[model samples]
Target: MFYGDKLTELRELNGLSRKDLADKLSVSEQAVWQYESDKVTPRIDVLNALRDLMEVDTSFLFEPNMVTRGVASEGHIAYRADDRKSRKKTRTELTYLRYVEAFVDYFEGFLTQEERSIDSLRSMTKQQADKIQYAGSQREQNLEIENLAEVSRNYLGIQSNRDLMYKIENSGVCVVERNLGQEIDAYSTISKSGRSYIVLGTHKKSAVCRNFDIAHELGHLLMHQHQNIELLTNEEYKEIELQANRFAGAFLLPGAEFACGFATLARKSNPDYYVDLKSQYLVSIAAMGHRAYDLGLLDYQEYRYFSGRMNTLHYRKLEPLDDKIVPIRPGKLRALMEFVLKSRLTSVDHIRSLFHVRPQFLINLFGIDQHFFDQFEHEKHSYYGGAKVIRMPGA
Candidate 1:
């Protein structure tokens, strides 16, 4: 039977409407609606057109379970979109995430069966907040954030900024970097199967900024998982963002250690004085300055002076050593692909066939270049009798 839900999902994934698909198919809008409503099955020509347009095999239309393998309710996504443009972007991102969840589900079948564990800070934060008779005070919230940061660090076994990204991946969070356009910075979402995803923008020039973006998304994953972010008012959204910022700050630069290090600085307001700390902590100059202010190491006047000086130097837009410091890239997905290829478990073409997408789609989705897939394509071979063999010359 034709799967109407799959057709609807693919159309929406591609950001198309009934009219749009109908126009593309040279049919009436009602015909497209009928196809999606399961009132009528599309003709073979239309089915082939859909297969080409959606980048899926024609047989996928008949497979009712293909798209629904890992699909949960759309309500599971907790995205940050404050404007119309951002809402549109969020829809596109959510669509991509559905595909990613499916991919992960398909890939997991090839791996060893190990129990995946995820720590939810939301429940912990709530329990602590209840124990403290929590009023919605900023100071109390900050204290809780600081405590959670410490707990997260300890739980993940992260010793320093160097191990932070690795710990996140090891904890089973999928991190991806892509060009999300200029409208948004980054976003995170959780799947019904407890899979966490953080998508970062690739356009961030500074490694410090990229790190901050990742940490911010991590904050959302840990603190606000399963929350309906779309219903938040602007003020409420701002508060959530502020909490995530504080989480990132505390996570990157812990309280006592960072304070001890900052106390050693010769001049508190000098941007150059923070260069070594920036190199060590992988935090932006602005963030370090704010940390100094927040910790009372720099008084209002000193912080204002430093802020003015940084503005005068125009370091906010592009900081020093940005080009030299390499930004962190995601490795979990790449490592999985490498393991599969190196182990001879599968080829790139086979993976593409499983996903029912083109090679370019995988390249864009996985944040990899063409050469990465091209190498596998060059080595692709057919299997016969459960083994790939080369015919030998007759002796």
Candidate 2:
């Protein structure tokens, strides 16, 4: 079992698919799978290759265990589950979560091995984790999504939205969905540890909902990054949720900054016009309600009026609904895959082989199907024209 559990974690941090990792190591992915499962061990040469490929000290692969000394939570339990479940069970919905944990393990290793500055990387990691989970900053209470995203970029070193999403997952934040039927809201894991993850609605949702859910999850990631590893009751969850909500607000709407935009409009119009607010800010009606009330931009009466208006907007007889479902935009992962393809870092054919999917997956994911791909072929394109399913990130 040498490096059995560690290999998958390293692979995820490097953002390598199993196939890509296999290619680098000259082994079949199934063989790699066997190694992670402890069914067989990697050769000494393979361990050396892994160390180099992942740019880590060999000592990382020999970490004693996931010994959690603090309070227990879902994340702690999940990681400390039967090693088979944690390292080898790769077919469940939580596969994405596993990838996230692996990334965290990798990043933690990278930081810990640097100059040996970690007096207690575990405590450092835990503190950051607590801030992400509980401590709500003044800045967070009034931010908008862009503001929040920017803070995340600077503090957490998010290079791009794709990177941000990857980190959120890698940090082991749990996302759960509360199906509102017409709408869905997201919940972050009550307890998170090494990996940050968020509980959000399914992918088969609308863009607006997805955006909100992402923002919501992002709130959980930032506010709860390092708080409690112990279990919490529903009341604790609510309290944390409120803090996250404030954090989300401030991240999305900077009170002073965005107020300037509203103040200018206040001269010419009323802030209570919910439609006007939504269009101008590109936020939802509900969001506008919270933002307006928090900032004293709208009184309780006016805000209530705006709330009523939201119900009417939901079913107004506008243009007939289109037959085609508006597909949610392909997110950051898809964007990176295209970048990798365009950059020639990897080939489309190779990606296809790695994903074990037909090419149409790529076409549909990148929206290559509805339009004529051949026209763009001669000029330049990131993916294949053949309408075959392609490899999803974790797949």
Candidate 3:
């Protein structure tokens, strides 16, 4: 029997209405609706056309489990883009997220389960919810956020700025890097099984900016999990963003440590003085300036003067050492794929067939190159060695 819901999901994922699909299939709109409603199944030719149109195998329409396991409603995606025109781009990203979930599900099946305890966003939220609820004033809320950041840092054992990505991955959060278009900086979502995913934009060249993006998304995962972001009002969304920004700031630069460092600055209002702090904290100069103001080291007037000077120097667009620091790239997923292939537990072809997606889709989603999948062909190349060829006695 054909699955109607699966067909409908595919059509919507492709941004096609019934009429659009019908036109592509050279059939009546009602016929397309009937097929999606399970009143009638598509013919062989129509199935082929759908397979081509959707870029999926024909069996995917009949076997829903072959593609995705859950509905989009089961997940909560928080996009970083604020423009209304990015709705289509958001949908495309959601599709990519679904595929990511599928890949994680399939890849984890081959690994042995361990009993190690790891702190996750959900667990932390439950532990801290009451404190957040009872907080009356904005000052109390800020204090709570700072406390949460301190607890989170200690929980993850992040002693310094080095190897931050590894600590996040070890905490069971799936971090992925991809080209999320120019508009989107990053996003976070929680799966039905409560798996956390944070996707970083590949367009960001500065490691400091990417680190801030990760920390911001981490804030969303810890504070706003399971919230339907699409239904949130503009004001509500802005408040949520503000909370995340505060979380990121405190998490990256703790109040006591950062304030002590700022007190050593010779010129509090000079942007150049922050270059050393930026290198020490692996955070941007602008962020460090804001942190100083937030920590009360710089008064409002001083912060304004600093901000105006920064704008005049054009430091906000591209700061010092932005080109020097190497951006941290995600590799946990790639390592899993390599282990599976090297151990002969599975092949690339089998994985692609299971997802019913193209190789380029996997390449782009996992941040790997074509050479990763072509390792077998590369191994076939023979190198000429200066050695005497000896014939065996039997030959």
* Candidate 2: regions farther than 4 A off: 1-92, 99-208, 227-230, 264-272, 312-331, 342-395
Q: Assess the local accuracy of residue 355 in candidate 1 as a C-alpha lDDT between 0 and 100.
A: 58
Model 2: per-residue lDDT, tens digit, 278-309?
44444444665677677788778866766566
**TM-score for each of the candidates:** 0.79, 0.46, 0.79
Winner on lDDT (1 vs 2): 1
What local lDDT score does residue 2 receive in model 1, on the 0 to 100 scale?
89
Whichever of 1 and 2 has more TM-score, that candidate is 1
Candidate 3: lDDT over CA atoms?
0.75
Give the per-residue Cα lDDT of candidate 3 at 51: 82
Q: State the lDDT of candidate 3 residue by residue for 62-152, as single tens digits.
A: 7755556452552377766656345556555666667788787676666663422233545755556446536798899888888888888
Model 1 regions more than 4 Å off: 1-65, 69-85, 120-126, 129-136, 376-395
Give the per-residue Cα lDDT of candidate 3 at 377.
29
